[model samples]
Target: MLTNAPSVAPVPTASAPVPTDSAPVSQLAVADALMSLLRDTTTEPRPDIQLEALTLAVSADLPVL
Candidate 1:
């Protein structure tokens, strides 16, 4: 069946600035975005072990496995 359907397009608002390829992003902004994304993801139940490993690796100036 052929029916007329209205197409929807996202209307950009003035409050939010759209990022462009040429736009320069700050390190803090990138880190914040990454942290925000990771915050919503599932993690191991024993986070303490993972945290301890990361802490020890950083303290020894060694790469995290």
Candidate 2:
């Protein structure tokens, strides 16, 4: 059974792209990438990793979207 888990803080990465105000197109790209990651179960088997990836993805794009 699925249970609600506490949100995890995003892992810091040096390579994470800095969000910019000038790019609306990249917002779609970020959303698409997030969807792709969520759909690919084989690449992200652990739920924690999935959650972290999702959190990072959304938070990164939230400012613009």
Candidate 3:
């Protein structure tokens, strides 16, 4: 079963620019960002790791490609 879980955005550093928009970002967007981060963090190109991460992300109700 899939469920929507609360996601917390990463804090920006002092040099990072803050957004001017007052509107809240969507959960899907947050999930996508997190997925990208996870992919980038992988040192080697392993299909198994990617597949497992994708499966876990989907099962956790995170938007994944």
Candidate 4:
């Protein structure tokens, strides 16, 4: 089967972007990020890293700070 479809990475949705603000202290957002950082991935989110995330979220008006 010959196909002309060149596979390419999918684009991110509107909600998804490089966080430029602090993360909201909402129960959900932090929980989701925490899960993504801690259990599911090898990357353990350091406090410093979290702080940076918080900064971005704040910048984005995420109400995290």
- Estimate, for each residue in 15-46, the C-alpha lDDT of model 2 and write its tens digit: 33444467333434555555665775665455
Q: Specify the highest-lDDT model's number.
A: 3
Which number leads on TM-score?
3
Tens-place lDDT digits, model 1, residues 1-65 = 34685532222333323446786455445556556657769967665887898999999999877
| Model 4 C-alpha lDDT per residue in residues 1-65, reported as the tens digit of each score | 34886643222223343343483234344445555546545667557888788889988888763
RMSD of candidates 1 onward, in order:
13.4, 22.5, 15.6, 19.9
Each prediction's total of clashing residue pairs, residues at least 3 apart in sequence or on different chains, is: 0, 0, 0, 10
The clash number for model 4 is: 10
Q: Which stretches of candidate 2 lie over 4 Å from their true place?
A: 1-25, 42-65
Model 3 spans > 4 angstroms off: 1-7, 10-21, 44-65
**Cα-based TM-score, every candidate:** 0.32, 0.26, 0.36, 0.24
Give the lowest summed-lDDT range of ten residues in model 4.
9-18
Q: Which candidate would rank higher by lDDT, 1 or 4?
A: 1
Query: Cα lDDT for residue 59, model 3?
Result: 92
Give the lDDT of residue 45 in candidate 4: 57
Q: Which ten residues in a row have the lowest lDDT in candidate 2?
A: 7-16
Q: Candidate 4, clashing residue pairs?
A: 20-56, 21-56, 21-57, 21-58, 21-59, 21-60, 22-54, 22-56, 22-57, 22-58
In candidate 3, position 46 carries an lDDT of 52
